[model samples]
Target: TATGKGFTPAFVQASRGWTAGQWAEARDRLRARGLLDADGELTEDGVRLRRDVEEATDRLDHAPYEHLGQAGVERLTELAGAFTATALGNGAFPVEHFGKG
Candidate 1:
């Protein structure tokens, strides 16, 4: 089920369920639309558009929470790092050694 790396057959199968021709047609349509280049990379316009979208989303949706101070930020950062390490560690990070209150 390999459609040559980066292109996952599982993702394609889930989306189209058995249509290489359909996928190719849709892919070609995207290339025609100037969103994807022939080499499968996003066109310059597509990259700029995606960046614009992300920047606009951040500008419109995210704001600095003014309530937290420097000390609070430091405490939160430590807790977040410990939590993430504990959850995702492969015996590499030892959160318990840091001790808990």
Candidate 2:
């Protein structure tokens, strides 16, 4: 979800619950590796890294819901999509990142 422009430490911390220290260390590493800028925006390399991470996490996130079956998955997806749309509408998320329309 963060491969888009303006990816930042705050965005990740809000979702991943990382500690300050962890984020600091990660920020340093990202800069040294030319993945992120000082402000935490992803560089091109960072975008690639984020894409890979997102792909892996997407798979992991899907497994637990496998027991829900196809119809259940569809229902859950619809609900989740609605929530995301609402979040976007309320300016809780960047439309460019979350908008599927």
Query: How many steric overlaps are in each model, in order?
Result: 0, 0
Model 2 spans with C-alpha error above 4 angstroms: 1-26, 37-40, 86-101
User: By summed lDDT, which 10 consecutive residues of candidate 1 come out lowest?
Assistant: 92-101
Model 1 TM-score, 2 decimals? 0.45
lDDT of 1 at 49: 65
- Residue pairs that clash (backbone atoms under 3 angstroms), model 2: none
The per-model lDDT (C-alpha) reads 0.62, 0.74
Q: lDDT of model 1 at residue 57? A: 82
Best by lDDT: 2
Q: Residue 64 in model 1: shift from native, Å?
A: 7.9
Model 2 TM-score, 2 decimals: 0.53
lDDT of 2 by residue, 35-89 (tens): 9887766789988888898799998887768889999999989999999899868
* Residue 99, candidate 1: alpha-carbon lDDT: 21
